[model samples]
Target: MQCPVWIFAACQSLNNWQQEAGSLPKIGVLAIQGDFLEHGKMLDAISMDWQEVRLPDQLDGLDGLIIPGGESTTIVQLMDIYGFRDTIKRRTREGMAVWGTCAGMIVIARKLLDKRPEPLGLMDIEVSRNAFGRQVDSFETEIHVASIPGDPVHAIFIRAPIVTNVGPEVEIIAEVEEGKPVAVRQDRLMATSFHPELTNDTRFHELFCKLSGS
Candidate 1:
């Protein structure tokens, strides 16, 4: 893989990227479930300001929040139970950047291919829950994300979802060689099937920060 070139040159190093710009953003990680702590650690390594959101009140003053990977159905239920569903929808609509990985992709999708229930429907694309099936089927591949800071990103898909169909307005940042959409961006919102936090590919996350203006 030749790898897609990174868009933001300032993002050379995750930590100093913000310092070079002379600002650190108030980022958030949805703690509704699964692999969220790893995201937090990634944020820390990048030297950006962030917090874990578990309540409606935590939504205040956040530039953006990453909805980490996990079981899709459970995260939505938790969002509803915690009164964050509407808040999340409203916030993203109001221009608060939202980034979701795996199950998180399932949550923000406007339509789910599996006929499952409870997606927040913040984005205009359609998604498939566990489109690749169980974790045992997990695999790695090099992907091209035009907005990132390096060559082809080594994407690790663990029981990941696939974005089957996309709306006209969505920008495809990453895709498989077969041309399946894997990462997308619409205004302040972004979602990916693979987990960038699980790998050394800080470009995707860093590109997100650039796009998000955080």
Candidate 2:
């Protein structure tokens, strides 16, 4: 059978990455709340070192940041209390690659269907909170990302948000059905409505590392 184009690209990327293995990108996981440690472990599994970003100053020496899945309201409230909201927005615009998963996706959206905790409005996308039902409705499914190689990624959704629309600059990388974007990217910003850290797959994280330009 003919190998998929993405598989070839993945192999090439992995080879290039291995050649530069001596210098992997420095990554940070937002640690105020959510599954930050899980993301850190995933990075460790990929032989990458990462710091836990709690204060705004800690965000300084990072090539990329991962906002793990958690309660959006609680995380937003903590961000406000710890004065990370404005700084995060500022740094992100200054060319920091950020990947938001699940509730993190909700935090970066330009608009939310419900008017609750205001979003950071970093990514030009609209999201519907808990669109995949509630905690009881959480489930897993295989998702294919064109840029990632190998089999489809198994994603876990827990009180996950859904990407309803994306702006002109946003590129939809993965979807569940026709016109339903599940993962999107714009410049250095990437967001996914499911938790990839919850699984053993590291391709998504690797893709984010590449986007970080490190």
Q: Score every model by TM-score.
A: 0.89, 0.90
lDDT of 2 at 172: 90
Instruction: After superposing candidate 1 on the true structure, give the runs of residues whose Cα lies further than 4 Å from its correct spot.
Output: 1-22
- Estimate, for each residue in 39-89, the C-alpha lDDT of model 2 and write its tens digit: 987776665668999999998878888888999999999999999988888
Native-to-model Cα distance after best TM-score fit, residue 199 in candidate 2, in Å: 0.7
Top TM-score model: 2
Write candidate 1's Cα lDDT for 1-214 as tens digits.
Answer: 1223332243345445555767766788999798999888766555567899989889878878899998888888888888998898777766789999988898899999877866888888999877777879899988777776457888999988889998999988888858888999988899999998887556666666765565
lDDT of each: 0.80, 0.84
Candidate 2, poorest ten consecutive residues by summed lDDT: 1-10
Report the Cα lDDT for candidate 2.
0.84
Candidate 2 regions exceeding 4 Å error are 1-15, 18-22
Q: Which pairs clash (backbone N, Cα, C closer than 3 Å) in model 1?
A: 3-151, 3-152, 6-148, 6-149
- Clashes per candidate (backbone, < 3 Å): 4, 0
